[model samples]
Target: MSTTTTEVLAFPNIKAIINDNGTAEVVVAGNSRVVPVGETLQDLRDNALALVVAEAKTLQRPVRVRIEDPEGHGELIVHPDGKVESVSYETRPARHRTAAPASTPAAAAVEASDSAAEDVAPADDEAAQQAVAADAPVTRRSLKETSFLVSAPVLEPATQGWRGALTRLGFRMNPSAEELSEREDIRTVSQHWPGPRTIAVVNRKGGANKTPTVVMLSAILARYSGAATVAWDNNESQGTLGWRTEKGAHDRSVLDLIDSSTELLSPSTNAAEIAKFVHHQTADKFDVLRSDENEEGDHEVTAEEVDIAHQVLTRYYRLVIMDSGNTARAANWRRMIDHTNQLVVPVTAIEDRAEAARLTLQTLESRGGHDAELARNAVVIVSESTDAKRSMTGDALKRAKAEAQRIADGFEPFVRSVVRIPYDPALVNGPIRYEALQPATQRAWLAAAAAVAKGF
Candidate 1:
């Protein structure tokens, strides 16, 4: 649980002692705060943002930090923000391959026939191959976004609308302006993760836009990624993720999934059987796992229960976006965080919801250890509150932007990225149809979803 930061600490005048809880006592200029393992350096840069620039103005050498981790190491470039700006890699030596002797035409024909047969393997063989693929080492660097890219030939320059004009002339189809950004967004969301990667959208406050954020992100990934994605409401009692999502033929909840999971998890069960318990969204193309609706029932979703449900989910989904209840201390909530690979904290422009988001990040940092990494790399989304404001007046919009910026500034020191979601009356309340949102609002959610996808 300890992080050995500053392997060489002669300069930078900073020191961190990571506690077993996953946080470290980051000391700089006799000031210290308990922050996540990966955030100590960020805190240093935050407190010294102006000081560092001023020192350079006064002809001083700016401080720097070199960071290393279990997965390939990289330096912590001294940028005031502390987010990973760039990583330099030393290429691995080429494997020495013994060239195969020129095959006879008959032998080559035989090999080609075998390769063709391998493409249409049976379901059992496909599952076995996927299982083996899960064990392959992941070499992505830590504290960096995971983006899978698709390349295409470039003809006209993408800048100044040349690409768009060429497309009008029926020459090249390079996306530009909004289209270009959307294309890049699809690339980030299209990553083919070997195992399931879950994103927990959490805030201890009820009106922090957690469910909507989960729904939008799930929809975005499901629509563009060409893989199965599911949004599971892991609340102890009831949740709204399924309510807001498009209704399906079945009314089965997570409890039903848990009950059937034993048979569903068996190798003999139909691969499609898991769908019986999940509700499918039509336009979004993702599934939803509803929570237990009984208000007075003693059946609280437990950590072990979540684990079982999660196992069933991973078999069918590449990404699982979770909508959590307000109780941060609950077993289900903590379990969600434990299983999560990326943390996306959704908040509103309102004061209380913003505080709740901040407290959640602080709590995770104090709890420290593995959770620290989740906290440090968490993406914070600030949405304009859906209260009576009703998309605010001109001056009110200015104030809202200021408020969103203030919240973003507060979160900058702790999280990897802060995305401000603009106010859209369509998303004020009720069912969120991704296509129904205003174009601007859709773009905002797309940006937020893209940021979330990077952490996958």
Candidate 2:
């Protein structure tokens, strides 16, 4: 028979600090290292685990490490066989001590008896100390309230980029920092609120990318959240939202919806009935309610009609994104602002567009009520120049990028958030679809949507 003995190793202190800028500083035994791969809290933990596992392998023994992060403090045990286990401790609340009441004669007698017993049986000191500890006034919270549970399933590694390549070759490498950040953005936009929410996309200048912003935001939110979202064209007369989105078989518009608002708002109306006025984007998983596309129609959408259409849409869909016209003072546009829970201002990199966005915000602020509050909490999205094509020179593209950054910076102080979207020819024209967007463009839109979601 053969006998084997294994030794256990321990490291007393390992600290991981996760920063808001998607980086982590790890300290091990007074030595610190910055890990660039800590885009999420889970990433920070995995990086700490990898560091301890490597040391344990070299020492040929199981190791234990005390890990602390912003979330909580815990301990991790790494075995030489590459297995890891975690033990978490609950936090104890502060103990408040009040003056003890005068002890009764019986209590004094019991205490005297206990003191004599303790002195007589000195070998039971450890047990006596444990009893004292057990009676202490320490209130422990639940483990869930103090720290993350290690028993949760680990997420699979990346299947893209170099890590993905290694994964295909059976190397089992974790995802990169960029991939983890993207996943976090996706999770942010893929949330459901308590009730219906409306986002108004506005800019007083033509060619400010309002329509495309509405379409892309709706598409991203719908695709990621699986929620019923609608992009409504709130133009006074003729709007291009219908021209740039898919059309239904009957060519129904918001006018038709206003006409049937009574039936749609009724409790007996089925969810499918609202589809008659909406054009569903098959690939993007969202619906588009177009403006009055009839060339000969002389009627404009009035404020009352806007209210009716909005009530009907809100009854049917969980999210409604309104695409506004160039006029900020129009009745329908003002009504849209009244119904808005979140305000999004879209601007191209052009100077004129940027100025118009600033003016629009100022106009809203002058109203000095819900409009002013919306202006203060609005999110501004700056898109690069559409003219900078692949055939353009590097210098021109660089200039375009510089202009977009300038516009983004100008609005950052006034708005809650500012997101920059790169130029993509797919977004320049034609019916927009999420699947048709480039990978970089899609990621940019996803981030933009997440920023907007934060307002909710």
Candidate 3:
């Protein structure tokens, strides 16, 4: 067997060397790390290099490094080109366990002491297996979030560059644009809609399963339609969506935009800029615009700012998936709803008809919003079971199917289509690429996306 070895060396200024053959080689300070083909070398030495840089910041001496490959199994020397001098490696405790301790009553007792691991193993293993079941390589980047790139074959003369891109990407335009000022900049499509078609996914009562709906729908729209998607984390009070999506930072907050841009010029939020703030996961095929980590910004984005964002986006993205706050407490929620084409209401399969879906229906009915009439407009997804990540058997699966019909019937006059998304926690927790979804689940989302495109 060929063994692969890597060495970390320190140098003053490390730079990547692009050879004539297009191979990239790096020279570390005064040393080099050569990687033989067909071998994997982790960049652990990068950290050591960082440490050396930190030390050097205070005018400290560069760090030292040493590596060994007894059989020269896979030759990777620090100074393959003799640029780097010499270094030595010191014995240290290994980072991972070399072997398991011999089985003993004491050892067994210690291992068994914690019931948490044992108890959780079955559930976790099942989930892990399902998550890995897809034949695709389980790369971290595959799980990490990503943004979309909208492309158009031909830019329409009447359509603004962005609007043309958006229309081609499968989004519907709202009729409300007619009321906009004739004075408003009107071009082909841009002239038709002057305000940002901001969408707020609000359902104040938690457990509405709001976050997953936002994330998944956004992924679908961006992936299939090929449009830029942004999930505006408007849930100010304890932003849970960010936590669920693994983008727990304020770097891309609305506040960040508010802080950077002057009153005269709200920062031109472009695909690339928005992409930076977003957690891009090409595997998932979408971007997450995380909410404020601490305090919501003092200045809520005004309707005009929202319009400007829409206009700016008209030049870039076709669709904008804003994951608004669920609670009524979020002031921005109302603004978002005002601009939405369709109000998607996802309901879990509950026994009592009135208990789960009545409120959502009643709210829409009260607004007397056309959203209620567009039966095909309002999408209702009845989950087969509560926990989608796990398997449903016997009574559970049967009951789940039964409940879906019950829920659909309960909201009849109001709901146009009742789609079903099985309870797959992996869809919620792991990297959910378009190709990874169950065929049924994918169809439901696409149908929802199609409905959304109608109202775009």
Best lDDT among the predictions, by candidate number: 2
- C-alpha RMSD between model 3 and the true structure: 29.7
Each prediction's whole-model lDDT (CA) = 0.73, 0.83, 0.49
Off by over 4 Å in 1: 1-166, 170-179, 295-297
TM-score of 2: 0.73
Write model 3 residue lDDT over 119-169, tens digit each, in one string. Answer: 667658555444434422332433333324322122122233454456566
Per-residue alpha-carbon lDDT of model 2 for 367-424, expressed as tens digits? 9999999999999999997854666678888988999999999999998999999998
Error of 3 at 427 (Å): 2.5
In model 1, the worst 10-residue window by lDDT is 53-62
Task: At residue 352, give the lDDT of candidate 1.
Answer: 93
In angstroms, give how far residue 29 of model 1 lies from its true place: 30
- TM-score, every prediction: 0.65, 0.73, 0.49
List model 1 lDDT by residue over 193-275, tens digit each: 67788999989999899888988998888988868989999988888887787777878899999988889989989878878
